[model samples]
Target chain A: MATKTKPNGKSEKNQPQSTRLWLMFPPKLITRPIVWELGQKFPLVTNVRQASVTDEIGLVSLELSGSRGDIKAAIKWMEKLGIKVEPVEINVIES
Target chain B: MDKQTGFMKALKCRECGREYPLAATHVCEFDFGPLEVAYDYDRIKASMTRSAIQSRSKNMWRYRELLPVAGEPTVGCEVGFTPLIKADRLAKRLGIRELWIKNDAVNYPTLSFKDRVVSVALSRAKELGFTTVACASTGNLANSVAANAASAGLKAYVFIPSDLELGKVLNSLVYGANVVGIKGHYDEVNRLCAEIAGKYNWAFVNVNMRPYYAEGSKSMGFEIIEQLGWKIPQHTIVPMASGSLLTKIHKSYQEMTKLGLVSDAEYSVHGAQPAGCSPISVAQKAGLDFFKPVKPNTIAKSLAIGTPADGFYALKVMKETGGAADDVTDDEIRDGIKLLAECEGIFTETAGGVTVGVAKKLIASGKIPANDSAVLCITGNGLKTLDALVGHVGHTREIRPSLREFEALIEAETKSPTAA
Candidate 1:
């Protein structure tokens, strides 16, 4: 459950920055309450950024960010839950 | 760039008039009323002329001298210059003298008028040295924020109600933005974004960055007047959601008159909303001074904010302008969408349908005069909300590919006319 800290040593001036990721799912995957199930994997997650389901898109994007390794593994585990993950590129990262 | 001549001294609260340093703050601490970027009118009046503006590019940034942002624009360089079409056929059908369609549906990249606002927000965010940009949106806004942010090389986090349409989801995700679907309604999603905005140093476009963001919508009003050869419409019908666009249009018209760019004339502003979730229209109908929030339930999901942030101001503007607010049924919304597309070849989403539908209702009810020119603001493209119209249209004729099949179809079509 320990988070992986990057050895890049950019700066500790603020908190270790984490980029939020968006994951979408099909309706059947969401009907089984799989998004919350994915949330269970990231025990150290500072927050479940967002989650939702609609008629037009079925299950919409859910954003989460916190510990690096915890977020990566939680996302990988979400694939098992039938969720599709897309890495949202950030142009500028700030604490 | 000489900031003193372009931007006003500072942004001031609409209610208290308390001034704040020109950062991105929107709300006032004393009354919670939203603040607006006030400009030095005399300076603009002296500099801005119809010929001066017309000589520039067709984009919204053409009014850069009047916009709030100080430096170079970082987004939506090609966003504005949308077509302002004359709806002659639609005018005859609706019994109006002159009607125009502000076709913002084809706005670049994301295809919603929100691109106008996001373009300003992202430009200011970069100028402030912020690394991340984010927002709480219904659907079109998320698409715009994600796409514009991606194009500007900024990380974007877009929050939305989980029940958004598929096209919008794909639009945002394709831009590689961190799109979040909150489990609650749009208001809840907006609240969560506000909380996150306080905790993080990110630029939340409609939140902390709203003062500059809302200013972007003024271009629509500016474009309409300029396109009409520097004459203001006597009546304008705008869709009501956040109410920012409606109020901003009103502001632009007034500024034009003040600057002597247009002749002084009395303008009436009307607002439209779906009956399913019409807090502002309901308040206006009841002749109430304040809007009472209601849980939204409508196909026009884009305008389904039960407690709109600017509902009060919207009501006040309608009353002051001697304008009326009206709502249309869901069936009418679909009809409005079809009516616009069929008449003017403009495909708008449900919000646009609400505007057109209510415009019809208002004209029939004698709220809008037949002699006045009316412009309907179509904010988003129909493709974003195609599911709302699925199965509501189309013909089903089980006929073989032959002259006999066609004859039979014509005979059957005459025998049983489908209800439109």
Candidate 2:
């Protein structure tokens, strides 16, 4: 018998994918090295394409490359830490 | 089908160099970058001369070569060419050297600038053999899409946030379009529309058909330069919803300069937003390249897109043009509406208030320079947002229909110190 896999079997969960996202850091999280923390906490490569930091807020446009499942987990962790994550653009819509 | 593509070369990705056929598509497959209409400038320059434009009908179609349609526009051909008023009184009030108002509040069919976009989108949709059209709107775009689709005898489904002003809702419903009120914000509506657009073959004006739809906004900029005696203003303040208008206006200036229609001159494109939902303005104020999305909570519903699609490009335009961005509070928006109405006799909606208010702030801060001339793009009419001015624009004093009573009231008012 074959070993049981996850019910919602996304066999391609380990497939590598890359996406661009905008991360917004509130005042409390501005001093925290969130990008470094993100890399350490997940099996993913993070590249900061653009960033702006002030005393009150920090906005970053980051490109992340990793397995689909790892990227999903990393984003979840970032959200738990109060980092606002949004896709760079909706794939189907252009303004 | 080997249909005529007019002066258009193809739809080219703005990020990558990839090109796609002129079809109902928007984003690049690999990079997901937005595609834009690439035109043959040499062909356009040869045909679209100043005299040619002047001799054509007083409508946006006069700049036919620049628009993305494959043939003569069969929809909303009468739209655009709204007046550009030299607002002397408004200039004095704002302490600016010169001021002008590009009033799209009087645009044909629909009172907003969205009509210009819808006309091009529907015309292109028809040429592409689409029988159904749709859009995700924040009231104004829905109104324009519904009206234009009705006029073109095409089916339309416009999705909008449920909490929009009653007047705007009625305006769309009156056109007999399927107005779907989503129980969410404009961003949510847009997201759902993106999904629907992918699943259905219908022409979503701002989704799959965006490259053509967005180019329609350039007509407003073209009209501005033409009305200003074929010159670009030193400063142009445009209110930001998706920020598409600001970017397209900048593109129009560049296209005109490249085509030798307007002499290459220096100009700045400033952006405005209501403080309650000012993602782009906030990012701009912080001197950033990317904007953080916000949940909108402003009375200026028309300019209340939290996740502006063109926010990145809008920022780039402002930076390249040496422009600035700012936001005004809800109260300030109302004050802006009142100021323009009282000073320029132009009753504009809250988005116009955002433009006027930000213009005042920029002028006061010297970002726009009080000595420099500027033009305010008033994109919508005030009547659609009457709910915002219900108790704020002053109440009428009821009077009995009697000459003696009216005389007593007038005498009492004259005796009062605050009468003026």
Candidate 3:
């Protein structure tokens, strides 16, 4: 299976990239409008594959399609908001 | 196909409520929420009556109306319907008033509760037109998938951690299924299996066939309720692996009530785990909803799923039913196996050991009332993991085949023949 990571450990700045991620939200961040903000703030495509939300936590299976830099920034932003993010297919794929 | 297809209308997302056609899929397209088998309860209500189920075959399929399969079962015909012993001596020993043992330790073919799930999964796998089946198992599931699939004439691929007990590994091999041992923990094996599931079209029982596979565990609950004369026990203590069996048993009780089989009673569900990998227990004790994943390090390899997929749901069921979760140490687990064996004459695997140990602790702490009826779910057979008790259980004397030697040994150990 082909992975979503940039090849050769590098990609042109303007080149488009796409990757699927498993996003985790702590109880405090679960109630926030994090998905809406991510969609509004980033120049990327947000395709949610799965989500589980309870009063204390939230988990989302999301795929973001955009430039590698934008994808990196989006993950950084989510991390800044205390959301734990990881590659969906952790072994073979890189986020 | 079975006429019950009308009863199972669609695969509904547990979180988002999205629906999809009945297929070999486990996740939703939109929210990745688990896809659960949806049933038209009205139709089931009309079709599946108490008398209707009681008159069916004795195996797990007796509750076929509630299972997710579309037709007659194609495998594991002899699985389930294990003895639900009254366990009087064990009950008295544990200081409980009334107790029952839902002993799946003697479960057919594979002597574990995994047979129930594997039976349903493979039957559905055949229904879905898959020629090959696979799974990411710790041990028992691998053994079950191998045995049931082979008997059903379906090729099987069992992936497991390389360090699984020899008994389990050979059990899979003797069934003539292809066994692959990954050089890592069950978590790593699971990750690789997930990637392989995406690459291959095989029916991975616990992965792609999960929706149907999990429903099979409901049969354990069904049998217990029926064996108790159509009444639910006041409490059910179950071992937690991926936390699926505990949740399914709870669903089984709910389904029974919905079908007018058992009286609606206030029953609590408790979960047990080995102390080495008790993520769910720790979370429940702290009153947390989500459990942080842990690195499993326990002799109870079968229940060593560190990050339980259904941990949250198991917690929800416990809270909804006013239940609790707890764990036992390795030493306590060994003591549990011996206690059940000596008192009730039932030998259970470590998962069962954890369950029995937790039940004792719960009763001692008054977390579970000793005055009420409780049922313990003994999921696997002790023979599967003999290493746990290799040096634990022993004979009084290794005597020769002579009556005089035996008599002398008995006299030495018990004081005299007239001691009693």
Off by over 4 Å in 1: A1-95, B1-6, B163-165, B184-188, B396-404, B407-420
List the candidate numbers ranked by TM-score, top first.
2, 3, 1
True contacts kept of 1: 0.00
| Model 2, position B377: C-alpha lDDT score | 98
lDDT tens readout by residue for model 2, A1-95: 34345567745667677766767898899999999988988989998866779876687878789986798788778878988766654422221
* Cα shift from native, residue B163, model 2 (Å): 4.3
Query: Among these predicted structures, which one has the highest DockQ?
Result: 3
The chain B TM-scores of all candidates, as shown, are 0.94, 0.97, 0.95
- In the order shown, the candidates' DockQ scores are 0.03, 0.12, 0.15
**Candidate that would win on lDDT:** 2
Candidate that beats the other on lDDT, 1 or 3, i.e. the better one:
3
Give RMSD to native, each candidate. Answer: 10.6, 5.0, 5.4
Give the clashing pairs for model 1. Answer: A51-B181, A52-B162, A53-B162, A53-B163, A54-B163, A57-B166, A90-B155, A91-B154, A91-B155
lDDT (tens digit, per residue) of candidate 1 on B247-366: 989998888888888899888889999999898898899897666556678999888766566776888889999989999989999999999999998899999999999999988888
Clash totals for all candidate models:
9, 0, 7
Chain A alone, TM-score per model: 0.55, 0.82, 0.80
When 1 and 3 are scored with DockQ, the better candidate is: 3
What stretches of model 3 exceed 4 Å from their correct place? A1-60, A64-95, B1-6, B184-187, B400-407, B416-420
